[model samples]
Target: MNIDDMESLDEETRKEIEELRRITPEKHGNAFFAQAQFNLGATFIKNGNIEEALEAFSNIQHLHSPKLYAAAQYHIGEIIESNGDIESALSIWRNINHSDNPEIYAAAQSYIGFVLFEKNDIEEALLVWGNITHADAPEQYVQAQFNIGICLSEKLNKEEALLAWSNITRLDDPELYAQAQYNIGSNLLERKHVEGALLSWHNIEKKDNSEAYAKAQLRIGNTLTEQGDYQGGLLAWCNVERLDDLEAYAKAQFKIASFLISFEYKQAAIKELQLIELMDDAEAYAKAQFNIGILLGKNSDIKGAVKAFRNIKYEYDSSAYGNAQYRIARILISNNDLTDYTSAKTCFELAREVFSYEARSYIRILELLEVPETKSFGLSLLDLLNIVLDIVDILTLNFSKYADEEKPFERKLAHYTSTYTSNLLLGNDKNNTRPSSFRLNTINNVNDPSEGQLLIRKLKDVKDNSFVPLAFDKKFHAFISCFTFNHDSLNQFRLYGKQDNKEASGMSLVFKKDFFQSKNLIGGISYLSIDNTLKITEAISNINVKESHDIQGQKIKNENDDQELVRRSVMRCVYLDPTSDYFHLAQRNRLTFFREFGDNIVIKNGTKQSQAEYEWGVYQEYIKIITEKFEVAYQILKTTYKEVETEINNVRFTLGSLKQKELAILVDEILLPLKYLIKHSAFREEQECRMIYITSIDRPEVTMEYGSFLYVEYEPSVKDHLDKIYIAPAALQHKRYFDNILKNVDVPVEVSGNVFR
Candidate 1:
């Protein structure tokens, strides 16, 4: 009967249980009764009532059914194990092994082995497992073999354990075969037989269609990396061709990239990283990009590197974001290009808000870049003003809107006024240059608006003596002008203001004092500022004069005259022009000024009578002065310029520094077309000559040093100027200039004729 129609008896469920037991023997026979008791015991075991389950299982011994009795015994072992009775559990499991049913026998054997393993009787566990060697044994028997392998491996008997696991591959079950192969590889790995382990793991892929193969591939790759075979490891990882498992694939790719970097194959690492298919995972992609940036930065590609680093979001991972921000700022500092200074400053400020580790260094970088310290200081002032303004604006707006409800407004005003007074009192530092504390007090609502406004007005009226003049000196002007003109000519100069607005733009030049002293040079342009009138102004007033004037005393006249020339060198000088195009005018003026003082002009020896000997000496001397005046500054600038050029050249270097196989790939894929294009151009003949020179240099072993190991004798048809010259060891002598030519020329050349062909 349904429960609703059940008898009105107070113990309905109890009566039902008794009725079920009464009919069970007749309805299901003795075997069914035993099975029913076992099932009820299993329910108790599932419900965590182990004692009740054991009591129910004990009743099966009274039943006359062999299969049911075996099941009950097996369940009793499980219940005893759950209750932490190891000896009793083992006894119950061993009893099941004597049962006549094959399935029950296999199950019992597995449980007995597990019990022995837990008891630390590994040998006995293996002995129990070894009894299940029949070919027709259930999959549980194969699983037992795998377990024995694990125990043997733990005992350090890896080889024999691997053999035991290998026998599992003969099982027809695909899952069992995969597990066995994996176990064998694991054992081999413990013994440091990396290749053997990899081979066994690879067999899993061949035998299994499950994720077991993917896991095996990852293990094999890790093993190869541990053994220092990075390339092999990467190749093994690439064997996981499962595009559906993009996360795993991306992880493998990242590992490969990290491995390549460790081996100093950065370009290869970047290439491998780019091949990862999962670009959607922002964290992984950002990490990969960040690593690429670091690699580029280490290799001196600062700008590209900074861009990569700066692309990471602040929200990704705070630590990683902070690190990327720090790197970006550092690269900006090293850039020497002031174009990014403002942005760098902003980035640093943002970084300060989230992380302070890089804040001070960023501040120092800004200081070096000459960003007005007042800019940051101004922010404090503005913050103070904003706070007062916000309070006043809110109070006024709310009061006007809700005059009828004046209580809340009046209370807010009282609170704001109190805060303002407290801040103002604390901010009262009369002697400091920056009213920073005062400003912070206002922003923190520690000062009244009127007092803060008065203080700000006084600060503004104080001449902002905060705006320090650029340190203009005679040497500074000369260096600045020269640096501006030369760097601009090289297409490397970037001014501070509008590109076409020359008057708004300012130029800076730096020098090192040690360089000047070493080179015996003086005078360089340091800084140049153009006013609205377009007049070029110098930062320094006094020009340096040479201590010794002996060199200044002597001079030579034009070619046809032997007259002693008058020395017209000026110790200090300034050239100024008010023209709109002052840079062009300044250039012309400088040319005239040096012409008037011929001794100051650099001279180079050439066919032209006006050509001077060693003009580089004068240029080097000019560079020396600037180097001296601003040693650290100029060095930083020089390094940055060099870095930029290096970055541009790095792409070429990547292909250029290739090994044999890599070089072959590049030549076949890239160089051949380049050669073909050059062959069809006007440079063909020149290219042919260059190609010959390159070929000759390429085989360096065949070309000995011209002077040290080999000698050349030349008898010119018109060398009458050299026929009688003595080859003196201590005086003027006629010596071949081959070494000099080689030292000066960038590209290799041969003297086919009087001309360098």
Candidate 2:
């Protein structure tokens, strides 16, 4: 009876046969004979000697020993089935005596159910499996229960199915038990009993059935997620990694990778997705490739991103291919390399079919930023910047010359500067001097940090999905000059800066408003309160922008009311040549699709580019920089027109579906003058009127004052437009010298002496 230590079935069976032989048939009345036959048959089956096993089992008879006889009969059926006689095996199993040997009888019934189910006899199989119980045979009983659950689940009897599956225990049959638990959880989830479903899945015994165990973990993760317990779901999914089931493991890893992104664990998330690429599931593998490519691009791993994108099969996922191609082109251009532009162009051509409008936008941008060695393709906005600044300074505030009789046509403005710099404006030099020109400083060097950009930061309502970064890559250029006119007294002059010495004496150059108005310059400053809260509705993308928090009790001006804001500025002055039906955006205003750190354009990392994380400032950079720009270039370059007008000779344009507010946000973000014009409320008392000159500063005639700052000198006729120049209190000491300097002039040069000093 202690045969547990036996090394082989042959040895154990031989010892049993010898002992049974010793109990002669005369003493045991043929019962020992039946027992010896059963042991021989079992040893034959173990050795895979089917014919010998059949012969041995057939010798056992129910009259001699009923239990041994029924067991031998069951062994014969197994041999018949293994030998391919399914009908014979089922016939033999069906005739087993249940009363004499319940274990063998249960096994026979279990086989019958399997054969019927395999033959599509669902009703017959369910009936057979439903009759089995633990009282008959524990192992066979659990197998029957598991099958019954599956059959009932398919038959729409969910409650019955759950009951059948729940009755099975790991102690009876671990593999079957695990599968049964998985089915119970799945059925419960289908019935919308989420908590019960998750509980069952979580309780799955992983014994040797890793497939079912892995599946259970996946279900638990999903169930928790559906209940809004994302952390719980992620943790559950993470548990699947312990198993060897490739499909389940890949699915869990994908979910975990995506979750890690929200927490900014980029490298860890990328590592997870990378593992999924080698896993068994085709769908998860493809998605992992795409997301990995995206994450790599964001992390600035260009080579790795490109390789990941290229690994995706176009036949597997064409949509992902197109999107990936579009990004590949962008990453190539983001490096600002001309050699990469060719490859980028090829990628765009491939992507154009899918991203018709967006791909075309970037293609046009490449043309504008084409290598200078080739035919020039830059936004020659130095002239345009100068022209738009004049247009805005001279004509903008007039609102098309408001025709209101009550409004004064004649206005006066003032320009405050140091006495030493003042002399340069009155000098005789042509381009270098200003009776001929006035100086324009770069917008960045201005006192207000918000110069050239004020609208985007304060905007609240934006459809981030529509965002496109302006494709124009060359350094966006804006030059600005500040002035205060409404209050041009000594106090105003002093507010500009302190008088360093005699040369730095702050002089307020009072001029007739008619002179500037005649010269196409305006006289008004729009001071905005940046201190007021900006209603942030859209997520700022990759473009660098300062971050601010939301708190109560702060005045919210642009609180979802986005329509009133204006987007047009000198930065994007569209020369709508209606005749050609083609025009370019104001390239000189130094505007961008979205900008950060003053120079880093974030178009490559826009939402449209499929960047999932939100740690950027450019809320919307969706620059269809179209007919106002690159669309014109797209039509010119494609030359793929049929009878329509997209031929190389003709011009075609693209205008994206931009809502007024969204478009305003996109354009306002890059408009260079708004950054200068919209000063903070803190400086409201200065009554400032800024003159912004947006242009190419790459080769500017910029003068550095006393080794302090750089400024571009422009020649404006200040003498002709002169009203009267006011002498500051410090300059009053040199009144006679000032009078002698302007003795030939008819205009007054008065002094405002501060008696308090």
The number of the candidate with the highest lDDT is: 2
lDDT of 1 at 342: 64
User: Model 2, residue 437: what's the lDDT?
Assistant: 59
Model 2 agreement with the true structure over 1-757: per-residue lDDT tens digits: 2334344456666676457446545677778878777776777667665676788789877888888888888888888888889999989888787887888888888888988887889899888877677998898888788778777776778789889889988788777777777677766765557778778777775664777777777777766764667788888888886345777888788778876875689999989888875446655676678778878878877788889878776675454566668778867765654248778888877766444434544565466457442112122211222232333342232212222222222245567777666565555333343343566665555554434333233222121222233232124445555555332354555655236643325677776643432221111111111112121111111111111111111112332234322111111222222123333332111121121123332235243332221112222132232222344333322222111111111221222324223433322322333344444444554555555444343443445567645566543356655677777766666556555555544557776533324
Global lDDT of each model? 0.42, 0.55
Model 2 residue 682 lDDT? 41
**Top candidate when judged by TM-score against the true structure:** 2
The list of candidate 1 runs beyond 4 A from truth reads 1-33, 39-56, 79-91, 100-102, 112-137, 186-195, 206-209, 217-237, 241-248, 255-287, 295-333, 337-757
| Backbone collision tally, model 2 | 33
Q: Which stretches of candidate 2 lie above 4 Å from their native place?
A: 1-28, 205-213, 263-268, 275-283, 313-757
TM-score of each: 0.36, 0.45
After the best TM-score superposition of candidate 2, give how far the Cα of residue 238 lies from its true spot, in angstroms: 3.3
RMSD of 2: 28.9
